[model samples]
Target chain A: MRVFQILTTVSYGDAVSNDCLALFELLKTSGYETYVYAENIGKQAERMGVKPYARLQKLRDDDIILYHLSTGTELNERIKALNGRKFIIYHNTTPPDVFVPYSGKLARLCSCGLDETRSLKGTFEGGFCDSDFNRQQLISYGYECPLKVRPILIPFEDYKKDPDAETLEQMGGDTKENDHKIKNVLFVGRIAPNKCQEDLISLLYAYRKMYSDPIRLILAGNPSGLEKYMAKLKVFAGELGLEDIVFTGQISFAKILAYYRSADAFVSMSEHEGFCVPLVEAMFFDVPILAYSSTAVPETLGGSGIIFDSKDPSHAARCLHEILNNKELRDLIISEQKERLKFFGYGNVSEIFMKQFKEFTGQ
Target chain B: MSTAREMLSDILLSSGAANVDVPVSFDDISVCGASSADGYLESLEREFSDRAKVIPQYRDLKEKLGGALFGFYINHSVEQQNEINARFLDVLREFKANNDEIVRLSNRLKELESRMDDNGGIR
Candidate 1:
């Protein structure tokens, strides 16, 4: 029997899209006729066999439809009408209020998304979400189906590509050996208010005050729809006299790899996430992580990295200092993070998916 | 306070950086293990952070048409958020004052301990 996954859009390098792409390839490898249909496909993804939503016709009743639920889309309404055993991969919707100030479209989309999630109560047969946090949200939304928690399938093999030469040269090859005075702390995410880039600047301000060594904050991700938020952050950083930051907006994978390779810490001040892929990425790259305990971050990290409960910049700055300056602690954290990274191991995750998938399909 | 984590906690506590009020209910949620956080590398990452730029014209025709509604509520929402932030900053101002005082007192105590250590006068 054939299987299909449908979503609003599959943008390149997005976490949800990445998971969908990996799962699509995995299903294909498993010898099932697999396809991905999205409302909009990224520029180069057409070559990868992702077809437009209009191409999704003639579905057999026995076929399976995996709908990715992360945003508001007409697909959420239309998927129920599709002829198949429909299941949803709940990526958890971002609350509308967070985006209301920046993008009314995003806000409206999220608002409609949440309402639609509730409206979709009896439509799905059985499905999975990426985190226990997401699972809980689903359960609370009154989903009665047999639900399970599956971590995102990070194609870790793809991460082994050679780091970008320019990025490596720019980072001076070995930051530790080359520059004793400067430390590189990096956060990879969009320049949205919810990601809280301003807090990174605040923490940098506090870190400089506490430590003699200066730091540069690297924020790697596209601004996407939040130009105003990014502008406000620049003004705040400037007012604080906070200089030396790199906001690499929507860079190539190789460039991102280089940042991960050269990074001392993978820091995220983001207040919301369904499953943070970068946390897994940082673990794979052996960079210690420091993240705010927001939404699914703690659940996603499990018992791996250092979790600071407060957003107080001073406390975060202190944690940064301890992780960077204390060899024993830093080493232990990295080692533990390596241990946690196995939780999202491709083999482990796929095995779990295949098991649940078998049970769900009753094959 | 003997476990590695306990020792780490002790160092942080002794230095007063562990003053963050972690709610008791949040313990089971796993916020303070070896596995959580994001850091700022003071100056080292500053150069990278300074070069932030957003690529333009990424909007498709649909997105451009939909863009008219992008920030439709920005005036009201931004104002509301600013007001809320103003209140938070007011409270934070007092919080910072107390934190600064605590830092000052902690430093003084440390200075006394150091003098005692140098003089061989502590028990």
Candidate 2:
């Protein structure tokens, strides 16, 4: 049987694109004809052998189409019209307000994506969601089809080793004073309003003001088209007279692994997360996690990390201070995260996917 | 003492008071008196009316309008403009709060000028 995957935009370093490519590999290994399609294909998409979505045509009854749904699009209507078996992989749409101050176009697209997601009540026979939070959202949207939870696919082994000498040097690892260690606080995600980099900066400000020990905060992520917001963050940091803060705008995988490996603790003040892949990555890297108790973060962490409910900068600062200073507490948190990471290992996740695929296809 | 223009600029930049040349004309006092919320709302209505008598009925007009008219320009303009607008709003609010005192001072100056005139230009 032929299996096809589709997405709105297949860009390099995107979580959905990574998931589709992994799924495509699995499908190909299983001896099924698989093709990937998207509206706009990025460079990585080309390497992954993705085709333009325009080639989607009338499919045979036995053929199956899998759509990686995140944002809103008119493609849902087209998917509903196709004569093949349809399946959806629901990636949660970001709340529109996150984009309001940055881009009205993005905000509208998110709002419309939510609307389109809601409108696709029975467009698919069944679907997979990345998290229970996203699954519940689909159910609330009146999706009555059978749905299963499949966590995002990440190459955990890529972060298993120590960062290369060049990457460590670039991130200021070697220049640090050997006499006294500087605690590294890291956050890895897109630099955007919803990710709450501003709030993280505020927490960093409070941390520096409250403590004498030197600390370096490394924010590693693509600016994600929020360059203005990123600039404002830098200015705000400057206004607060903050030092030792770095914004590594869109680094390579080696750099990402380096940030995680070198971090004393991973702190995330992001308000919105649809199964935050970075949280799991931090866990894989054995860095203790500190995240805002908002959205799917707590659920994704599954009681492994420190969850701060307050938005108060000082309160967040206090939590980070306590986590870094208390070696016993930090070790305990790291141990729990390692165990939690095991649940999302590729071996187990792939098994779950295969079971669902077999059940759906009845082959 | 700094000049009025320098003071205004200082106020625009930082919070501590500076010598600003606030024009306290008699007409300025009168203009403040006439600029109430009622008049402001009416002017807004007239402005909207002048733009287009018929408002298009759409479910997502804000998004549509932002995309069509301001999408490309406003995205670049928002960061700098937002800062200037925030500072301007702070100054405007301060001016509104001291309006009565400003009017009273203007009238007192006017009375002094009239008395001086009545005394045949103060001999």
Candidate 3:
């Protein structure tokens, strides 16, 4: 059966884009014809060899429309025109209003909700949420559709081993003692308001006060219209005398893998998300995580990382210190994370997705 | 013919064969005898001159009338223009009275269309 996936854009560095790319690969392996529809296809889409359709009229009755959460009013008119089966895979926790705050007039005109749950009601046949927390949010908002809560899992790439002594020496690490002495913390995601870079900076400042040992905080990823916020973070870090914080802007996927292997732990203070892919990647690397217990963070972590209430910076700082100091606890979390990683394998996720698609199409 | 009145008479007599009844004094002729004739000539001359001068203005009015007539003919060909124009203002008043009924019937037709299954196809 042919499946048509609709998304907002195909840009790299977006979680939805990455997830859809993984899904496309999974579906293709199962011998299904997949086509993508968007306003414009990006570099990642071109690299992945996805064909674009300008409009939804090109879809046939045998097709299944798999709409990502980014589909808005543009899909509404086309969805009303479809003669095929439709399903929405909600990837974001909140709706369009949270993304674009100045859309009140448009929301009223289109009869969509300002909140997340209310907007999704009666519009889809079945939905696949990124987590059970999102599923509960939908039910609380009175959505009576057939909902499936599935955690996003992609196939794992083999962990790249640390470099040899000679290469390590060239890279300026402790090659002679065989100790990775640099206490590197990595944050890998978009730099946005909701990502809470400011909050993470505050936690970093507090961690420095408690410990005199030098820790290098690496803020990696593109500044997504939050350059001013990032600049403010850098200024604040300087004020707190923590200028050694490294801001490596957007890097290659290979470089990212290297950074994950090199870092001691992964940290994030994002206020909202449907799922955190970096946390999953951190677990894949057996890197212990320190994250805020908000939205989908706790659900994604699943007792695999150190969680702290985000409202209090001191609490977050305390969690960071414990995870950093205690080697036994960190090792235990890493081993548990390795066992849990089996469920997120590509074959398992693809099997579940295919069963749902077949049941929806009755094929 | 030989007197002053007869001299004026001789002048008219030499020009035509009609009788020339010249007044005894030229002033008497100017004031009394020729008063009605002068008034009649002056009025005729004024009326003829005014008529001659008004010919171009009449042509301009005719051109304006022709344009208005052409515009009205073109407007009448369109189905709704006559019902909207001020010249056909009675039609506009009639349309205002019946517009609500037309809208109500249109909506009713749409509602009926939606109610019909039509093989479960969307309209």
Which candidate number has the best DockQ? 1
Q: Is the docking of candidate 3 incorrect, acceptable, medium or high quality?
A: incorrect
TM-score of 3: 0.65
Write the number of the candidate with greater TM-score, choosing between 2 and 3.
Answer: 2
On a 0 to 100 scale, what is the lDDT of residue B113 in model 3? 86
Error of 2 at B45 (Å): 34
TM-score each candidate: 0.77, 0.72, 0.65
Stretches of candidate 3 exceeding 4 Å from the true structure: A55-57, A71-73, A93-120, A140-142, A158-178, B1-123
lDDT tens digits by residue: candidate 2, A133-171: 999999999999999988887766656666666767655
Q: Write the per-residue lDDT of candidate 1 for residues A1-363, one digit (tens) a residue.
A: 889999988877889999999999889998899999998899867779899887677898999999999988877877777788988899998888977655677799999999899889899899788999999898889899888889999899889999898987786564434543557799987777678887787888778777777677889989756654555565556556775678887899999988888888778888989888889899898888889999999998887787778788878888888877788887787888888888899999999998889889985
Interface RMSD for each predicted structure: 13.7, 20.7, 63.4
Best by TM-score: 1
lDDT of each: 0.77, 0.73, 0.61
lDDT of 3 at A116: 34
Residue A268 Cα positional deviation in candidate 2, in Å, after optimal superposition: 0.8
> What tens digits encode model 2's per-residue C-alpha lDDT throughout B6-114?
3323333543222222122211222222334123323333433333333232213344587587666655555455555556555655665586578789999888777
RMSD of each: 14.4, 16.1, 41.1
Chain A TM-score, each candidate: 0.97, 0.93, 0.85
